[model samples]
Target: MIAKIMGVLNVTPDSFSDGGQHFDIADAIQKAQCLIDQGADIIDIGGESTRPDAKPVSFKDELVRVIPVIKTLAETTDVPISIDTSKPEVMLQAVESGASMINDVCALRVNGALETASELGVDVCLMHMQGVPKNMQLSPVYDEVIEDIKHFFAGRIEACISAGISESKLILDPGFGFGKTYEHNLEILRCFDEFKSFGLPLLAGMSRKTMIGQMLGDRDVSTRVTGSVAGAIIAVQNGADIVRVHDVEETKDGLMVLGSVS
Candidate 1:
């Protein structure tokens, strides 16, 4: 199946990629429109930078950053809007502001997150992260990354269901760079089909990440577009249902070419 594209719109100055590029609300709204024009199926607006060793943003600040963009986009676009946040308050306000999906890196494990998502009645993307963003990459370890992620997804799915969220409303993200080494990220991509056994849509976010840089001779984030597109194609070929990306036009072009021959 062809994978859907989720355009990355970070309204923060600290994200690993495209930070400070759209920190302004007007710039963010323009970027969202550009992504839609490039054939993005969803727009993911993130207020906080969840990159490794990233400092946390307060609830008030985060809400102030993302809510306006979400509200404006909702008024102007037909594409689904996803709020990339783990905070329950943000989730609630974002949904109320017309965000249709909640893309949480914490897999709704934070206190009251699951309940908030459940009550909000929005689709949720439960991602697998080894640790908190502040220290996720510090000596990361895993006992069989694929199996561990599957186990983690299973537990999070059960928890979502137990909290009154419909099983059908949950999506799973493998979280390629969060708390993962280069090898772990590769293994997850190579065995991505294994996660399809759960019968949920899989989301892969590998655009312009360190994993791509590691393979491209430590290329800078801005220079990793080609590698990012190649990695995104591999992930789609391996059964990724949604690909979160920084280069929306390039990645969408790649998917279109691949789709024609698939």
Candidate 2:
């Protein structure tokens, strides 16, 4: 099957990429529509910036940032909406406002999050971050990256099941760049398929990330689109079921060519 493209919409002023680009309600709605028109299969909206060294937003602030956009899109479009947050309150509100999925960097490890996700009954993407965003990159260490992530997923999956979440509702993400060094990120991509051992859909999100920048001789974020597309294609080739990306149209075009050749 062709990998689905999940478009990123950050409604924050300090995101690593495109921050302040869609902080307004109208602007956020417009961006979501643009992503839909660009062939995005899923629209993942985030009110908080989980970028390294990023400060946290209060629950009220995050809700104010994302709910109006989600409500408007739910009323305007038929596209699936995914809330990119780990806060249980935000997850509950987003789903109520029309988000059909939860993309949590913390993998529902936050207090009350696992219970909230289980109750919401929406698809959940559990990402593996070695540590919190504020200091995750300081010195990320794992005996074996791939095996360690797999082990993490196994424990999270069990916890989700124990919390009354269906196994089928779970999606796995290796949390590229969240706490990984450049070498760690590359190693994850090289062995990304190993994540499929869980028998669940795998999501690969490496769009305009530092890894791509480092691979391209430390290119700036704006110039890393081509490299990001290449990473998406490679992930798909290695069995990624979905790719979370910022450049939806470019990734779609790359996937089209890949599909034709394969």
**The best candidate in terms of TM-score:** 2
Stretch of 10 with least lDDT, candidate 2: 1-10
Lowest-scoring 10 consecutive residues by lDDT in candidate 1? 1-10
Question: CA lDDT of 188 in candidate 1?
Answer: 95
Q: Which residue pairs in model 2 clash with each other?
A: none
Q: Please give, for residues 115-147, the per-residue lDDT of candidate 2 as tens digits.
A: 999999999999999889999999999999999
Q: What lDDT does each candidate get?
A: 0.94, 0.96
TM-score of each: 0.98, 0.99
- In candidate 1, how many Å is residue 157 off? 0.6
Counting clashing residue pairs in each candidate, in order, gives 0, 0
Candidate 1: lDDT of 145? 93
List RMSD in Å for every model shown: 0.8, 0.6
Candidate 1's error at 106, in angstroms? 0.4
